[model samples]
Target: MFELIEPIATVSFSKVVTEAFLALGMRNYWDGYFAGRAAPLGLAPAEVVHAVFYNFADGEVARHVPWVWGKTTPEEAIAVRERSSATVLRRGIGVLAEAPGLVRVADLAARAAVSAPTEGRALYAALRTLDVPAEPVARLWHAATLLREHRGDGHNAALLAHGIGGTEAHVLMALTLGMRAEKFDRLHHLPTARLAAVVDGLRDRGFVDAVGGFTDAGRQTRERIDALTDELAAPAYDELSADELDELIAGLELIAAARYKRSDD
Candidate 1:
């Protein structure tokens, strides 16, 4: 059931899809990710990106904004990622794309995505303005991307309400999920001193132990944040009937389970 949206939706940002950005002379990791996500916003400034994106370190946001635009127009970046993501999804989903349920799922997903209010949801609002593809496979992925960014925006709001800073949020995730802190640091360009400071702050607040595992209080806090995020994201699905949601989840699971290697990979 959890695979309904994000698991399929996030393929838009996957490395396989981002590789298309490299053809534009963009770097692989940060450049592709930030540019593809922000391109829909049309030459958005770093401040807007920093404000809307949340969570990532400011340095991480700064690394690509403004400059990526000079290398490639937002429309080109958008087209590249969309085409790339669709190719991966189409190849992976194979016969499932032709299944009768697939079109229904895409329609159901789009209904839910557009039904949600856009106020205070920057990423969702921006992405929603784009033309949805006519093809079912592309439409399904587009619907998923809309819902994913919409939920992510709500998740950010949930974190803000709890007074959780960006670095602190990532810190709690690593501790609670049993992920290595070093791994999180490797993905994000957070400064070593900043990471140490965030950990220190969490320790001071009794959120983590000296060795960085979550204390009971920290675990409870994360549970609360997760619960709030789910609550906030629930509105996006309001247009779907309970039965429709079940069908959507089932349909998405079938698509996500499909296997195919990306040619670029």
Candidate 2:
């Protein structure tokens, strides 16, 4: 019953304000959203492979994310992403079409073209320099991904700044989401003993209970970390006007609603 998100007026000024980060966070949601409709895309090995391909569209193959998941060899993962880039991109945009009011999606894409770029987000910077398709949805997808990567890069920095390593952060997040810790131990390639030590540390810090579930304090702490991450990510949007930000929120909400509705069906 703890409030799941901050009030709209306080933490959210617009939909575009957070869609990339929101979308970036919802890999599971996207996986669930795309779960049933795998016929035409020919996504194989089902669950894990589809997720790997879907995420790869927003990221390049050589990056850490594909390898980090532990579902396949890094080489195979890279090849799958690289080979299926166009297919994944096509399917990703197709999901947007399932939503109502695509005119808003187009508006979001156009306004995004006006935002200034920033430094340190290598993927976003590289994406901005690419010669991608001229189609509006494709452009919007790319633009949103750029913003997602920008926010992602910033999130990594904030995590590092807070002295959180990749494994511990993964464990903490998985636990908070009600997933089995053993699953993450495998997914993150963390040793059992190492994961136990991290869990003990979390328990000592009052982040976990005797049974290893999050304490109330742990949940609050997770919320604080999320809010701090958003604060750290805000600099990427510093140059945009209020009007432009509003359009982004509107557009992303349409897409999210459509996808979530599709998910519920």
**Best-fitting candidate, measured by lDDT?**
1
Question: Clashing residue pairs, candidate 2?
Answer: 15-249, 16-248, 16-249
Residue-level lDDT tens digits of model 1 in 32-131: 8888899888888998898888887767788788889888898988888788888878877778878888899889888888889899999999998899
Per-model TM against the reference: 0.92, 0.56
Report residue 205 deviation for candidate 2 (angstroms).
4.0
**Candidate 1: regions farther than 4 A off:** 185-189, 259-265
- Which 10 residues in a row give candidate 2 its minimum summed lDDT? 1-10
Query: What does each candidate score in C-alpha RMSD?
Result: 2.5, 11.1
Error of 2 at 14 (Å): 28
Q: Give the runs in model 2 whose Cα sits over 4 Å from its true position.
A: 1-107, 110-117, 185-189, 204-206, 260-265
